[model samples]
Target: MKPTEEDNKIINNRRDFIKTTAIAAAAFMIVPRHVLGRGFVAPSDRLSIAGIGVGGKGKSDIAMFAKSGRADISFLCDVDTRRAAESVKAFPKAKYYKDWREMLDKEHKNFDAVSVSTPDHNHAVQCLGAMQLGKHVFVQKPMAHDIYEARIMTQAAEKYKVVTQMGNQGASNDGTRILKEWYEAGLIGDVHTVHAWTDRPVWPQGISWSINKANVPNELDWDLWLGTAPYKEYVNKLVPFNWRGWWDYGTGALGDMGCHLLEAPFSVLNLKYAKDVQCSVGSVYVDEFQRGYFPESCPPSSHVTLTFPKTEKTNGDIAVHWMDGGIQPVRPAELGDKEIFGDGGSGTLFTGTKGKMMCDTYGLNPRLIPLSKNENLNVTQKYKRVIDGADGHYKQWVDACIAGYGKQELSSPFEIAGPLTEALLIANLAIRGYDLKIDELGEDVYPGRSAKLLWDNDSMRITNFDEVNQFVKREYREGWKSITL
Candidate 1:
């Protein structure tokens, strides 16, 4: 039955109700970490914070903290002084530094928390440094560039007993929570398959390292930017935004958008692990020799099929298929209605034994098939939407800190998000033309295998090659280093 107009008015009013400043302040101070997954209160009366990498996304992060009207912005660190200088206006009282390590050493015990917004490779080192000093952490997503780093950060957060949050804000959206409630209510029964895809056709889709060397920009510190990544001459094409398609710095399109697209499944299904992973690669976006162009040694696009084995505790297996570059799955013929697939970057389709559910990647909104259903058969659900206030993500973080309450709860917790990130990064690793097998429960992948070995059905481990070991970790630049567990 349709909701009555009067009923709709109340619902709409509640959704639009603005949280008063006083109430908002009280909520944080009173809330606890494990209970308040989206809010936190620091132990101190006043919280000090330092921001590393204040450009692009960092610009937005710094501004959010400024507007929180809570935290004391103590320091700003960025390799690019010009970019760092632009953000100085946001926190006029804060000091600026070029080296993150030097900032941490000089500003020791000065900050109660740190916000790490550097590229994937540097997240662990910067975050761990702050946490080692008993400081809280808010690190950007793709948690780490590789599996080992992911594990190290997760363990470190536990060891330090500090509040830690990953930057996957979509996890807290009302729609995402609704999807979880629907699944728990059995709206989708025993999900067996899922399809997630992203349409991130950003510039520099994929370029292998074949390019005519070009002059490096004087304004940019290419060496500092490359950090621990392999040494290479400057090619303006891969700098700025196109690095996502490269192997050395970014994790291609999947890693770029996977955390957003994969959040729903990873949260709802407890998709704690996967096995029997196989990846199919598409043609390179451009010829390999086109150096310094868009894709500096990455595939333009590819599709990976990750099949999970049924454990003794479960009766059925689950398969997840990932698509990119305008690729999509053919709608299952059994469903009666056509589903709404958002025109945005990424989306998820959950298929269960009885019905299906659909959601856009960012958890913006969701729809259920068979729009009409019997109440007796369907379960009841309630949703409370977070009001529009933390328009800036860092505002959410800083506000929690000032309240002197449990502040580790993240918009995205690293514990839940770490595996989801690893799954996507592993998928990207598979596309590098390797047959990879991972032990989900063991939290490790087979170390020995050939590059082109085909997927094995029974063991999931490739019989001939050592794919997992190749990504164990990476070598760091002399000064720029990742934190080890």
Candidate 2:
């Protein structure tokens, strides 16, 4: 059955076209398949995973996920295609998608897990959507943009029967465990007030809100980028990095740095809830004519005082004071006077009725006050666990994941972590609203201040302030509903 020369040429051309077309289709659809692996590794199954947002902190998250040789990452989603493309160098065989909604719809059920490293506003929606489809989730710190969203996430994670982890990587640190143990042992003796601080002098610290509204870029889908936040025009300062200080995109200095700074104290003291929170702000950082660094919508520098009610519920009542942006606390002059009192880097100072202990946030190293040769004041106990010198926190997560889905303990479970986050977030809320006051108890405690921000947990809406309250949970732009447990 030898073919004629003309027939042979025609067949060859047709075959080449089919081959090229198949390759192109795989390039598009293979994101999930490539990222999730055709079949998960047996018994000790390899997790099929995808990454959303691969720039800035997202890039570091990608690297962390990569460390887990047990997982296969085939799909990389990023609004900035350039950033997404750069990520492919690590997993060349993986696929890429610019829009997560498209990927989720077209490639649903492909992945066993998802890494959500998007902005604060986008975290809940994306994480909820992923978990809705029976997928495991690993989200970045400060789990949600607001208290209500954090509560929703907590409930959803429980309902889904899926594994969830927050990005408070420090929670897994052996030092944190040791601190918790120390508290149980009553080493610090009923820590009454905790002073947490940070020297986060990152770029545009005070100048974050000075963005000049401009036309959206061709590369950025500014509409989609806005996500749940109200439709607003693109501004130069709003994008990339400085969004951390803005009320719409972020929770200001406290939300920006509080999760990390307050971890040690929250962990050691088990600060559950605050009975009352009173905040006062110093002079706004402004020009001669009182031109604030940010718009009138934002807070310049604030000092907040949170008082936890006394109860027979384990430990005694405690007070936590948060100081940021060069606004130090008005406390025991002994601390204000000493240079050590105002060390002010990212850390926590535990002022007990007896002595004080200060620990640098992530470094896990603490020292008792009076730098003089006082050997008796040293914290004799040390963390004997391996987390002290482990390969970055991500490895701990992977090791836990490998031990089988639900068997491992999370570094920060929603039960304890959620409330601590609320305490810090409340500080951000108070900073933005003037004359804000929450009384000893009652839903309408902060009267004459801002309108009551009550949550319709069912709808994820704040009853007051129609304009901004809608931000609680954003309407996903088509094919992007949240993943409910």
Candidate 3:
């Protein structure tokens, strides 16, 4: 068969065009998505999501996003083979990867957003990588394991101009807004102190890490699971859950619930970084005669107090007390003896000049003192409610990402979640400081005990106690780097 002369010319011209544009075409394959923002993706159209740590909470998070009907789960990554099974089944067509680094490197263009539900230690790096690719991100709380990580995440969110949200469902609830309205209206005038408590570390804490190395589970990638954390044997019970008690992995009870409970105060009072922190923690019994102090594990019980300087909403400094491991403040005299406190699981109480108010976990079941007061409470509706409250959190972020950066208000953006997380991690500095032991003579002595550690929020360090600053920005394991701007 012979081609016409005109067809032959056209084919040669097309081949030359391909040769000239190939380099640019390859580079454009990984171009920053933010450069293709609103005009590139219609706000009313669907979104694609890539999920890391797709099991347990990760599984539910992606499910919620998919349920929004506006988002498609396009990728799933998890180190544990078994944990990832359900998500892989649910999104069978979505590509699966055991290593998130591999997943992002190869398929960053396939998704419009990333949902990070990995361990606390890995959140910063994973989320930062996604943002570097210009993908909107939704990260689980506490946003990061260390103060530096949280700060970096917040700054990254803004720098990248990507829509971001922390997985604190309460932020989308009506209670926080209602509380904010009440506070702004002076119903609870000038809140001076807040007490937030949770019963957590339901997993073991205040114990020694198992020196005994166990065989790595067949379904788990132990090294990948460790991520930025230092190497350790894969203990039997640490997977699926129980990692929360270890300092290397989780942020203890405060990290688990502080964002949920303390978010109300942060929002209501417009609070940011803490001025100083101090704490006391319960001891563990290694034996009948010896007290077990495991520096690697979070204490069994702890009470941390963080002081925040005055914001526009208040006249003076605000003191927040965080109690965990089932330790709770003395019940308010106003609460009836038979009445359950904070729905019995966890609660936060705000003490103001005029009166007190409280709410259960997730900022749900908000109540004013005497309970009856809530029945007749009236304040003008101020904040717009999410279309469906907490469940709408995912949809809110998805819609905002499509709408482009700064186009919509988000309930738990990293800008807000970061400082909230810092306060908790700062409190952790005091909490972990309690475990700092030094040798005195022949006996062990504690220097960080009962110390009121001053915080230079700008520097993100403990001015009075340098030892605790070691945790402000933890050292990552070899072969890993902390995510930065």
224-323 in candidate 1: lDDT tens per residue?
A: 6777787877665665677767677777778777787888777667775566566665554234674222323456556777776564322487788888
Pairwise lDDT winner, candidates 1 and 3: 3
Point to the candidate with the largest lDDT. Answer: 3
Backbone clash total, candidate 3: 0
TM-score of each candidate structure, all chains considered together: 0.78, 0.76, 0.90
Decreasing TM-score order of the candidates: 3, 1, 2
lDDT against the true structure, per candidate, is 0.69, 0.65, 0.90
Residue 82 of model 3, lDDT score: 95
**On residues 1-485, what C-alpha lDDT tens digit does candidate 2 reach at each position?**
89999999999999999999999997765455446667544434566778888777777786777765577776888887655556777777767887777878778777777788777878888888887777777877777887677877887777876677777776666656556555555555667888776655353444533357677767777766777766666777466776676656676677667777787777676666665555665445455677443433445566777776554423667778887766654444444355554345556777776566666665266555543423654445544454533234565556555665567766665666677677776565555444333466555343424343333434544345334443444454554455344
lDDT of 3 by residue, 313-353 (tens): 99999999999888989999998989889979688899999
Candidate 1 Cα outliers beyond 4 Å, as residue runs: 1-44, 210-212, 285-296, 309-315, 332-339, 370-396, 399-408, 434-464, 478-482
Residue 286 in candidate 3, Cα distance off native in Å: 1.3
Q: lDDT (0-100) at residue 71 of candidate 2? A: 71
Model 2: residues with Cα > 4 Å off, grouped in runs: 1-43, 201-211, 282-297, 310-315, 330-344, 371-392, 435-485
Q: Comparing candidate 1 with candidate 2, which one achieves the higher TM-score?
A: 1
Local distance difference test, candidate 1 = 0.69
Q: For model 3, what is the error of residue 338's alpha carbon versus the real structure, in angstroms, after optimal superposition? A: 2.0
